[model samples]
Target chain A: MLVRFWGTRGSIPKAMRAEVVRSKVIAALVAADGRRFDSETAVARFVDEELEMPVAGTYGGATSCVEVDGGEGDFLVCDMGSGFREFGIDAARRMAEGHSKTFNIFMSHMHWDHIMGFPFFGPSFDPEVKIRFFGGHDDLEEALRRQQEEISFPVPFEWLKANIEFNKVVPGETVEVGGYQVSTVKQYHSHDSYGYRFEAGGKSLVYSTDSEHKDDDPESEDMFVEFFRDADLVIFDTMYSLLDAWTIKQDWGHSSNVVAVDLCSRAGAHRVAMFHHEPIHDDADIHRVHTETIRYEELIGRNSRLEVLCAYDGMEVAL
Target chain B: MELKQETRERALIVAPNGVIDHDSAPAFEEQLHKVLKSADDGALSLIIDMKDIEYMSTVGLRVLMRVSKRAREASVDIKVAGMNACMCEIFKISRFDKVMQVFDTVDAALAG
Candidate 1:
C-alpha cells in the first residue's frame, strides 16, 4: 500500500509569509557561498545535498487530507482538509485517465479544519461520481450539511451532484471498504475523534490524529498500543512538545512527538510519520522537533527499531 | 519500586531508588500517597529526593504530578531535589519543574 500526504498541517491552514520565504532564500544563498551552478541539475543537487529541508523547502500549510493509494476499485482518503481541493482536482484528471469515479472517505472528526475543503472539492459537484463517508460520529452527515448551509457557504449540501453515503463505524468492528479491512478506535478530543487501522494484503497502516494521551491513563495507552501494533506506518499527531502537551496545552486534545515515538515504539510499529504539524511551528521548528523525536526514540526504543518520518505536503511512502 | 522514608521536624522525605517506569509507577504513587496520609500535623512538608533514580518515564512523571496535587489539597508543601541529568531533562521537557519546586540538593530543598 502507498500513503500520500496532500496536507499535513493541523488546527488551521497556514501559508508561508513573504518574510519567511525571503529568509529561506537568504539562508540558501549563504549556504551556497559564491558558487554559481551552470545547470539546473547542479542547483537541484546543491539544494538536495547541501541545504536542510527548512532552508531548501517547506512543510506546507494545507490541513489534513491524506490519500491511500495501491488499493483496488476506488480511491481511499483520510480526512478532507483544505488539501482535498487539490486532491479533488487531481482526482478529476485521473478519472479522465480511466480511473474510477468512486471515493471512500474516512473522517476522523468534523472539526472545521478537517472538513473545510469539502466545499471546494471538485468531485462533489460531479453528478456521475459516487462518494462514501465512514466515521465514528453519528452526526457525520449533519456536520457536513451544516457547514454547507446557506449562511456559511455558497453551495448547499443538497445541491451537491455526487451521491454521498455516510456510514457510522463502531469501535472494534472491522469493515471492508475499497478492499481494505478497516477498524476504528475512539480517541480523546473535544467532541471525540476516531483513529483508523487499515489492513491490506500483508501490510497495515494506522491513521491516528487529534488525540491526547494523558499521563494518568494507562488503559488508554494500552488500547492505543494495541491499535497501532505492528503497523507498517502510523500517521500520528505530533503537534506539541512534551513541555507544552503536559503543561500549558494539557487537555488540548493533541500530543507531542515524544509521546508519539514512545507509543509507536512500544507497539513495535515499523515506522511512524509525524502528522498534524502544529500551525504555529515554522519549518525550522518542525525540523528541530522531528530531530528531537528521533533522538528520543533512540533513547527509549529498546528492543525495537522504529523509523520516524516527518510528514510533509505531497510526501508518499510505499509499504 | 523501593521507597525509603525519613521524618524530619517539619518534613517527610521519601527517596525512590531504581527506575520509575510503567511497571513501578503505581507502587511509587501508592507509597507517596501512604506517606501523605500518615504524616503528622507537624510534618507539613514533603520532599522527594531523586538522587538514586536511574530513569523515569511519562507514567512516573504523572505520579509526581498527582502527588503534588494531592499535597497541595492537604496544605502540605512539596519539593523535589537531587535529580540526575537525565531525570532533570525529563522534568524540564515535561515542565514538571514548573509544577513544583526542584532543587539541586536535598539540603537546598530543605533549607528553602
Candidate 2:
C-alpha cells in the first residue's frame, strides 16, 4: 500500500508554504553535517527555515481529503473538504477505466471544512458516478444541504446532478461499505463527531478528527481509544498546539498535534497523518509543526512503530 | 470459563482463568460481579488472580472494565495479580493504569 500526500496544508490556504519541502531541504542546507540540535539558535533556524513548503499562509488551502486505493479501482475517502476538488478530478480520471465507479466517503462530522467540497466532488457532479456518504449525524442530508444553501453559496442543493446517497450512522456501530468493514465511535467536538475505522485488504485505517480529548469520563475515554486500536493508519485532528488545546482551546472541539501523536502511539498505528491544520498557521508554520511533531514524538517516546506524515493536497496512496 | 472463590482474613480471593475471550466475556463478567457483590456484603477486599489465563480479547478487557466500575460503585476495592506483558500493554494503552491498580505477583497483590 503506497501512501502519498495530496493536500498537506492545514486550516487555511498558503503560498510559499512549501518553503522547505522535506528533511533533505533542511539537511542539505542546515544539517548537512549530521549533527543533533546543537544550540537554541540552530534549532530555531531548522524549525523556521527547515521544512517550509510552497504555500502562502495556513490557508495553503485547508482542503482535507485523502483517498486509499491500489489503482485497482477501489476508492475509499475520509472527508469532502476543499481538498475533494482535486480528489474529484483524479477520481474522474479513474472512472475512465470503468463506468459506474463506486466511491465510499466517511465524513468525520457536519463541519464545513469536512464537507465543503461535496457539491464540487467531480464524480458527484457526474451522472455516471455513484457516491455513498457515511457519518454519525441523524440529519446528514440537511447538514450537507446547509453548505449549498442559497444564502451560503450561489448554487442550491438541487444544482448537483450526480447520484448521491447518505447514511446517518451512530457511533459504536459497524457497517460494511464497498467491501470494507466500517465501524465508528463518538468523538468529542462542538458538533458531535465520528471516528471511523475501516478494515479491508488485510489492512486497517482509522480516521479520528475534530475530536477533543477528555479525561473526566472513563466510558467516553474507552469508547474513543478502544475504537481505533491497532490501526494501520490514523488520520487525526491536530488543529492546535498543546498549549492552546489544553489551556485555551480546551473543550473547544479540536485536538493538538500532541494529542494526535499520543493517539497514534497509544493505538499502535503504523502511520499517522496529522489533519485539521489550524488556519492561523502559515505554510512555514504548518511544516514547522509537522517537523517539530516528529521531534516531540521522539522526546515523548511515542515514535515507535509509527510513521508520521503530513497530508498534502492532490496526494494519493496506493493502498 | 467459571469462577472459583476463597477467603482469607477480610480479603476474598477470586480466580477466573482459562481461555477467557470475547465470547466468554459475559460469563466472566457475571461471575466477577457475583464475587464482588458477595464481598461487598462483608469482605473487606477482593483479589483476582489471573495466573492461569492464556488469552484475553477486547471482551475480556470489557469484563475488567465492568469490575472496575463495580468496585467504584460499591467502594469494594479490587487488586489484580499475575498479568502478562501483553495484557499489561493493553491495560497501559487504555490508560487503565490510572483507573485500575495492577501488580506482578499474586503474593504482592494479596499482601497489598
Top TM-score: which candidate number?
1
Tell me the spans in candidate 1 whose CA falls farther than 4 Å from its real position: B7-12, B36-40, B43-45, B74-77, B97-100, B107-112
lDDT for each residue of candidate 2 in A1-319, tens digit (9 for 90 to 100):
4454445444444444344345436545553356677798876676567534432213246466666664464577877777777777877876886733778778777667777777777676667667778888878789888888888888787877777888777666789877778898887887788888878778888777778875335466555556657787778788776545544467888776766766567667777877777766655566877876776565444237567777665444444
lDDT of 1 by residue, A142-261 (tens): 999999999999899999999999999999999999899999999999999999999998999999999999877889999999999999999999998776787688899999888898
DockQ of 1: 0.41
Scanning candidate 2 chain A in windows of ten residues, the lowest lDDT window is: A51-60
- lDDT (CA) for every model shown? 0.91, 0.69
Query: Model 2 segments beyond 4 Å from truth?
Result: A1-5, A8-60, A316-319, B1-112
DockQ values of all predictions: 0.41, 0.03
